[model samples]
Target: MDVLEAIVLVNDMVVDSSSRRNDAWPELDDLSAISSSFYRDTDIAEGYGDSALEMELYRLSIEKTRNLVSSGDLQRQLGFLPSMREIEVLPVIYRDRADFVEKILDSIRSSPKNAGISTELHRQLNGFTQSLNVLPDALQNFALFAFRGFYYQELAHLTSASYMPHSWRSGIIRSQLNRSVSRFADVAIGAGEKVRSKLQAAINDEFGAQVISANFPLIASFVIGQASRRSDLLRTAVEIRDSAKATAFRAWVYEMERRIRNEQDLDKVKQAQDELTTLVRELEVDLGLQRKPTQEMTLTLALPLPLTPSIERTLHVSSPAWVRRVLRRRTHLVFLRELAQESISLPPFVRSYQMLKL
Candidate 1:
């Protein structure tokens, strides 16, 4: 089979991306599959005869082709997002005009010019490098932006406490966008439709890159492989898990257990019960409950916060430093996430929240 055939089937397991079709990249289902008399036999031979890099491309090609077999309507639905995230971090956008042209050609051939993004295709793609400006911000949310919007946020968090230019994002953005773009291309082509030119350019810039395709899965696997390393990343995951409120919950549980263990004096029993009641009241205070009783009406005061950390909650944390960091950033990401959910969709991970608009 052509190169696309090899990898398309690999995703029969990874149900995240094209999870719509068992995680395979739809590009594989297109003309490149072995079913196509054109490149099928030659591709398998090239597997042996080609350079190791070419062979890998041949292999990825199989995934690309296999992916094409799924329903083509994906593009019409997800036309706005770009295919790659690196396109954003790139100091210079564009310089990859031919690739975008290839994308629009594929899109138009598959679907109507009016159905997807519906703007004039020719007007959007008029600039090559100039089009690169579209890589940053909310615009990056589209399939054209690929996963750049998400990855951009992640790397910004990873690179520095504050977002800044860095070399590392190249690797991060590459992997994310590859998955995003391939999926977008799959559905886009399947639907036989066209979106805006900026989006099409993004698809090409991301998919066209040779460097990104090579490092993505390897790095992603490595990053994902070490449970410990990931545990250390962003320094906020653990903190979020063991948030102060969560710690309080555990403390309350321990006090509850301690009371259960001791069944002696009725006064002691009553005190324990009162303490537990006070703790719950304190929680309401910490959460900023606003229904203030102006008068001393039975004193429904909030309980005080515990001075000591919750031992059980602390133990659950794999890494406290990362957890703490995440906790620090969480408020910001939460607001951003709210905006994303309300205004736009935020990607699945904290990494997707790295860069911010306001």
Candidate 2:
């Protein structure tokens, strides 16, 4: 058969198999079966394809399987967060720049982090990154500065006694961070140059000179205030004043906050946060940071952070509390395994987190 016919046959096999199985997770069984054939066919198509039709059939079959799972089966499996499932399914429905943004935010929200200063910083970073493009010129420069401030602040904590002991694992994380920083340094610097150009342009506009001078202190104050919210970071900034790095760190913070007041379009703010979080964890080889208790830190005292205004409104209007409760009860590990089975590459930190428990 042709590619389309082969895809149809594979889908029918999976769907019919699901109907026949009399188990709690017949769908998973169907998935397992289809996944096997998809892989087998994919190998043949890629490696031994004597004709274009054979290659096309194998590729289409694989594509069809992913589409089916992402839209239908993955929902039932990864129901821990409806938004996450929606994120995975969204590509099938909408394929545009705006939707790309939605997809990213959804991915960021789905990323898990421990409750503490780290998590809060992660959220803020995400918000900043996602909103970067839409922000006013002054704000965009501020965001980059603020981002560097937070990055260093968090990096300091990870290097602290409270986060991880000085061991081989810690060394690995440091090495990874070093590499990541090295690789991204040029990119970050290039972006910074652009921001500086924009800042200069804004300054040359009207009364911009006085405004620029005034902006540094305002941003510095905000960065300091944010640092104060996390005892470890605040302690690092204040107590470690002698270090030149600390001085430069705070300078970057002030420089960034000099112009921006607040974030715009909170919903789009996931990229900065997600990227930082992902990179930070990538520093870890395997559970590189030793876990510490933050029970005394009053995590509950922190203000509630709704996903986005629109999501918040929709949740209030439609989704019932019981449904949320049920979603929380879903087996996270099972869903994670299913995602892997479907040939989805789970993020390293996520895989590490789950594996450490086992």
Candidate 3:
């Protein structure tokens, strides 16, 4: 398909999946309602356990995919129209790795001394994220399931990491690393646990059923229940990893929290932070993982649109290919591309000088 057609199809699929009522309650209990392909692929109808089990697994996969694509509640805010608002929502785009570091420093500088500045900063960040909530359903889903939970999750983590005192840098990095490990473990151990929980909640919400419905159809439910049992095995593995992490976190936090609570001397606090850092690195090795976080800094944009109810979008573009979506103004895109080409052709120092001028 052409690019536009492909894009349209994707958006249609997302909208349909998201808008469908009672989709969470698929009529899968009746085998006759399902397509022949399901039976053809499965051996369950043939009286073999293998095909039925495969069908159940496939259903779980399809269900999980639907949930992830429809999961985000990210919506755009009203009152963003440039004509109505005095100040237009300027782009707060992070372009490179350096930009991420700069944001970290900016967040550190904005940290409150007496809770006042911190409170204001928190409010502003909240407003910013609220504006982002109104992004397209598909975009929001991609951001959450594909991106770092729609940027807010990463933003919150970054804010916390930077808000600490400079002496606590090591401790902050360690905590960040721990979170990364937890995320990796979450995916590795329980592939769709998070999305599944969201889907299950949606199902329960629709049916007004308890968190789990005990009244599943006998044979069909048993087949589906087997998938849950398999997921339980993975959950057990995740729990083991989480347990080890919690033990290490507890040990480190004991001394760290004690120092903070007692208002201990800077040197002592630094010592505790150092110990935490070392412990985190050792734990990473023990867990057969990287000492440093593997996440890359993303290129993000906050662009405003002039509509009756103005909206702000959070765009996460990994490369120039995705930049087209962010550049609503074709003129801006043309200017940017020209500038990029020129910069690439220039020497490093000349390019830097031109960038500073821009």
lDDT of 1: 0.30
User: Which candidate order results from sorting by TM-score in descending order?
Assistant: 1, 3, 2
Worst 10 residues of 2 by lDDT: 12-21
What value does the lDDT take at residue 10 in candidate 3? 16
Question: What are the lDDT scores of the predictions, listed in order?
Answer: 0.30, 0.29, 0.29
Model 3 earns a TM-score of 0.18
Cα shift from native, residue 357, model 2 (Å): 42
lDDT of 2 by residue, 1-358 (tens): 0111122112222111111113433333444354433211111112332333332332332333243233443223323222332233222212233333343233223224322433443444344345445534333332232222222224334333112211112222332232332212222222323323344455567664554321111112222332323323323222333234333433433333332225453333344334333322222212233222122321223235665332222111322345334422334212211222222122222222233321
Per-prediction RMSD in angstroms? 22.7, 29.4, 31.0
- Over the stretch 1-358, how does candidate 3's per-residue lDDT look in tens digits? 0111111111111111111123322322122133221111111112322332323332332333234334431111112111222112211222222332233224324223424533443444444334435654334322222222222223334334211111112222233232432221112112212222334466688788765432111112112222234323222222321333323433344444556556777586675444334333333333344333333454544447555453455544333333333332333223222222232223332122223321
Per-residue accuracy of model 1 over 23-81 as CA lDDT, tens digit each: 23343334334332221111112223323332233233223322321232223323322
Looking at candidate 3, the ten consecutive residues that score lowest on lDDT are: 7-16
